[model samples]
Target: MSDRKNILFIMCDQLRYDYLSCAGHKTLQTPNIDALAARGVRFSNTYVQSPICGPSRMSFYTGRYVSSHGATGNFVPLRVGEHNIGDHLKPLGMRPVLVGKTHMIADQEGMKRLGIDPTSEIGVHHAQAGFEPYERDDGIHPDLVLKPGVKYNEYLKERGYDGHKNPWHWAANATEGAEAPRSGFFNDVANQPARVTDEESETPYMTRRAMQFLAEDDGETPWLLHLSYIKPHWPYIAPAPYHDMYGPSDVQPVHRSEVECEDPNPLAKLYQERISARTFSNDERREATIPAYMGLIKQIDDQLGILFKFMEERGQLDNTMIVFTSDHGDYFGDHWMGDKDFFHNPAVKVPLIIADPDPAFDATRGTVNDRFVEAIDIVPTFIERAGGTVPEHIIDGRSLMPLLRGEDVAWRDYVISEYDYFMQPFSPKTGRVPLECRTYMIANSEWKYIHAPGYSPMLFDLTNDPDEFVDLGRDPKFEDARKTMHYALADWSLQYRQRETVSEERAGQMVGLEDKFGVLIGYWDENDIEPPAQMPDYASGLENG
Candidate 1:
């Protein structure tokens, strides 16, 4: 056997769980992810620690909750002295190399790759962190028009394009060819894709880099590489073959109702526009849904094919522990949301496929582990697979090594997912609304217990109401059930989640404090704040006795 095993962590930007072929998807052929899942374990209810990009990515790297990491949103970095998996693996003689997008950090470094000036305020926080982020060469996102498989701009230009244009439109129109030439990704020519490819987009590049690392014997040392992709996420454009991979009618139908506004979460209404790409008629959705969605997934799978083939050819298929997952899930038109950050099924559930490298440990493969798993589990699992140690300080995730070894143990009775409702507070941020009453969910196989601060809570009997159209939390018949799950959310929070404690007087001092420090939004309230107790990390403690 090799002295140590390699870890191939393939992360997609915002892929949902149900989109993969291994998990009951019929129309989309994700042979690559499928092949990996066929040889490993797939979790039916895997979740993201946080729903948004920045916070979720922070949890993966730190293995801590947003409460602990103090990075509850985008635009902030895990504070200095904070431990990260990369920093953790460094001592173990393992180098944690990041090959692609890390939406976790912005600001301090310029967005040189995207060509945005650091001084332009386009980036989130790294620039605020005091590093002169690489200023954009010309100020534009490179991939706007530069997809992998098919070259778009030249094709459009060849077709006699005039200006910029977005090919994706309600009218089935291109944004540029007529008056705009579809507005290249570059303000001038940036967003325009010179090429588009199914697998070529994000997953392929990430896999290629990782495969190169995996194929390298590199003496007796093992490698831990995080292949992060920005695609299958947003600006949802899949390159051809994939772009034309499937018929629109063949796609899975989206969740839409005449009464979308009746959901009453208020959050449901507040973030309506931010979540979905656009409102589509039933007929429009039928024609547009499957083709683009399945095509992107198929593209992601194509890369998986390459990565798996590389592993198999190199004799490392069964010798390496491969973890396949995403930062979070996409809405996919579920609950009228298109992106993530919402706690709906399509937006919250991501695929977690782990393959044990040892034959003796391979029993866990080909089985569905339906436990409530989260992205945080990755680090502990990786640390153990390499025969290294799992650090107590940085990791909140339990190692899957026990499950892999067939130990008779349960992982988590429930999983917690958090979201910030700064956009629409039931009250107001003026110390009047209570920071929009953070929403937390404690979910098990039978139900989902959601606790939103100012608004009435939500409880979905996922077993029965999988669409989550019903509110079981408020139902008197399920009072006991609601209490049971609510307690779980509360109890779990008391155990792991933490946030700043600021009194009214102390809060006033922080009004203009933006001049000095970063913001870490709190998911907890006064009633929720019981501490044994170190104060909030904020200097000059917000709450004075």
Candidate 2:
């Protein structure tokens, strides 16, 4: 085996923090994932920078907050010049490869302005979020018109599944129904089994592609493979055995309350009234959809089992640092919300497990860390593990290698998550301006505060009301807590490292360069300053007398 470490960074989409057995989900038995957790550290309070897909994944790719990266919503392009994981890792001679979803939309306008060809290697890397695309699939192909000739659809067609125009929808995202089959897009039939087999589904397909990449790898070169899976997300439908693995009896009790829906913060109320939220709020819909959601997760776990076994057989496990996490969590009707776009734990907190093959991490095996960590942290972690120094001025997150080594470090006390709802209907319906549609959530171990511009802030005392049944944003009793969180948010906003071009070392070196170059702005006489050796004729032109 090569001395250099190979990183296998696995990310699941819309997976809740507590959905795995190791994370305290009683019914969802994710033995493969739990086994990985048993051999690594599992972070209990990991949060994403954003609750939505594109922004959250962008943070993971760039190691910056949503506000800093400026990709705050789905389909929003990440700026062309933003440095991503591949950018940081490539300099260290580590190849960062992607197998599945990134939800990255290319910055075409920025590319045009820069005069870069879209088909060029540099342009392709920028479009794919800095990864060498092995097989890029965003996993949502509703129709050919919306996304014509998706690669997955073509793969399905080659495997003799071309009955429908978009086989991805019919085979993977639809279920048998009374009278006729219905698309899994409707929550009513989500519990039904999908038309395809488990092997042909999205999770297994992505896993196979990842295994193929590993199989073809030259062992001498170090690499980071981002095996991102799009599953347990909406269009909730599972294939065959996985579909019947769970039912209403296996579905966990929904974490919602009448009080949450009765009198909510204006922003929260808007989310509650969303079509997806209202559908999830129905008892029957929850019963129908959650089982399929769990089934999808179960399928992903099984796929991991296969992938891990394959890696072990190849002797790759001994040399690979395996990281398992999600872009963000799903709401699943938690706090009366369906899709993730809020400050609630279910929407933002995600499961993170890192199993480093290095013996340095053996002491912390199977440990549960409660320190607050964010999605942005993964970038620096990969960079450090690849034998590169972490550029703190460029990356917004700290490397977790210290924590992994069982070393005591001063970690951050709070985490921040942002949401920009301007692209959504919330801005138009509420009549709020585009900028006012943004919201920021700051949370410590005990309390969570949400600050929405032009609207009342929302607060939740996690110590007392862990389920977040009541909103304390308007209550006078917790005004001090709210104010403290606001200060924290403000401090974070002011301290953003947006100047990526200048390093702290470089800035410090620049302090005396002008003075050394014989440019003196304040001086009384020639005796007030020492002239440079290169300029012996230099004079201050002023007299001390």
Candidate 3:
């Protein structure tokens, strides 16, 4: 509302790059999201910093990789002192507000050590990934303990939708069946309507609240709204009309090869055994569940239309910058995998669309960028748009403004994505060694290299095997390519480890500034500083000498 630019960042959970019509899915159509691409820049090769939820979102929020932020898994709290987009934006007088999920875990130990009260204003921001939370709902992880009157649950009660018995769980996730009473049973239910009506569903609720925030905004200062939606992740069910929109016929053929599954990478085979992909191997299960996944995505597209219209009516489109992306991608049985935890494109590659309404970007609008971008780039992008200087040492990402303006600039030739499976309950059960629980992926347009400490590195040649059904890691013909990639990975790791060097140098420069400016702690003026305690004997001795 102030003349300053505003940012509306919309992120969906577990959304794949190829799902949207604009991204070229032969069957599924997302005209609303596609329309955004038609008027903006759609990046084809964008990747997230991690393949899982909490770490991925943390990377996006902080503009730092999982290793830098140290919130490597779900329910792992972000370190309290780490800076985020909110911290960077504050210097520019902008507030980054959250409309939905962040999946941020509070650093209880850090908070206690710092003597910061959990209920205080600053404490809440510190714990919630540095966001001044407008409304925080991590979107009902099936394992979360739900209580009464917590935002969404309260809204359900007020709306007269009693979720069978557990209103919140039943409405958002449960199906009407014998399995309805079982906690987390709906996660495997497919092609069925949720217990709540379409209007009462979680997607619609988040959309409506986001719109309300826009309408209630007084326009006093430029603001950023992280309108994050938690749907299309799991509990593969949608409300009536959306639930039945797609069926078995719409499910894309699984892009997997039997040979790869037969002799998979060590980590890959272990993950396949642990997740729903193992269960969905049955044709009937894949068909039933894939369509439900499509339905959930369709519902999201419809809600985006509503949000876009609201922005248009408010005459905010011309002055606002809209960015749409996802935290990660669902494997959907790709390579015999289900939930994201692998470096496959289906699990790590996500759609990234940026619509800058500023006139300077007119030439690049509607263009597709093949340049490599990662989730860490998001916060820096927003900071640059808000007219704030990005702290290079603190933020590991580069701004996309140069590309948005159609300027020719040197861009990174490769991107990095990693995942840590050590925290999973199944890790110990599988007899996985400590090093085996971690994996790192480095890739470029031509080759992708995956390194797991205890196993042989995996390599995929994108030009030949686009589906990544073959492993060239052990193949002699690709030895040169494999070696080159391994060196790149090593160089990247070393560079990342030095990110703190610049910050330390900057901190060192401030060592004498306090002395130059005169510390007022023990003095009111020059006369007050003339005491024996304040004056050093060396000062006069040096002059006499």
Instruction: Name the top TM-score candidate.
Output: 2
Q: Rank the candidates by TM-score, best first.
A: 2, 3, 1
- Model 2 whole-model lDDT (C-alpha atoms): 0.88
Candidate 2 backbone collisions, by pair: none
What clash count does candidate 2 reach? 0
Please estimate how well model 3 matches the true structure, expressed as its whole-model Cα lDDT.
0.83
- By TM-score, how accurate is candidate 2? 0.96
Task: For candidate 3, write residues 1-545 as lDDT tens digits.
Answer: 33679899999999998898899887888998988888889989999999999999999999998888888888789988788777888788887889889999889899999999988987887887777777788767343566444688777777775644356676667777775443334455666678778888888899998998899877678889999998788877787888889988888888888888777877678777865777666677788787878888999999999989988998878678999999999887888877788899999999999998788889998999999999999899988998877787888899999988989999999999988888865688657774568889999889999998767889998998888888988889889999999999988887743355467568777564444344446566667653222433454542321
Error of 2 at 202 (Å): 0.9
Candidate 2 vs candidate 3, TM-score winner:
2
TM-score, prediction 1: 0.74
For every model shown, what is its TM-score relative to the native structure?
A: 0.74, 0.96, 0.90
After superposition, the stretches of candidate 2 with alpha carbons farther than 4 Å from their true spots are 144-149, 176-181, 531-545
Q: Backbone collision count in every prediction?
A: 54, 0, 1
Please provide, for model 1 over 431-484, each residue's C-alpha lDDT reduced to its tens digit, 9 standing for 90 to 100. 434355467767888888778775667788888877777766556899989888
lDDT of each: 0.62, 0.88, 0.83
How would the candidate models be sorted by lDDT, starting from the highest?
2, 3, 1
lDDT score, candidate 1, position 136: 12
